[model samples]
Target: MDDPRSRILPLLRQGERLLWVGQPDPRVRFTGADALLVPFSILWGGFAAFWEFMVVTTAKEPFFMLWGIPFVLVGL
Candidate 1:
């Protein structure tokens, strides 16, 4: 009754056997696509942030400034 597998015992079928209990490695590993994606993301995010800044600071139209908020968030 002290076994770790006891936690899941209720969910098993009448004759089922527990063979393995494990979790995947928690790690971050970048791949080849990241070489291209990293720079592109930086450019897109930078432009979006700049546009939002300009709209918020100098643009007088409320609707135009508000529209850029979503773009800035997505860029992040």
Candidate 2:
């Protein structure tokens, strides 16, 4: 694979220096807030998905189903 930084070098202006070049660590780091947020997020997402599913299956109007689509995608 080509160096990812190669593409960035030409974009630098004259006399400018590239001091740092690196990729972010591909690891999951959790904070104390995650203890509350994680479960809340799961419940919120589950409810959104369930709402969309019910709307799609039970609703006769297209508007109702369409309204919940964005919420479902955002939940994902």
RMSD of each: 6.3, 4.7
Minimal lDDT window, size 10, model 2: 22-31
Model 1 misplacement above 4 A: 1-28
Tell me the tens digit of each residue's lDDT in model 1 across 2-72: 66687877789999988887666668577789999999889988998998788878987899888888877
Residues 1-76 of candidate 2 have per-residue lDDT tens digits of 7875887899999999788888767685887899998998888789989988888778867998888878777767
Cα lDDT listed for each candidate: 0.83, 0.83
Total residue pair clashes for candidate 2: 0
Q: For model 2, how big is the CA root-mean-square deviation? A: 4.7
Q: How high is the lDDT of residue 23 in model 2?
A: 74
Model 2 misses residue 42 by how many Å?
0.6
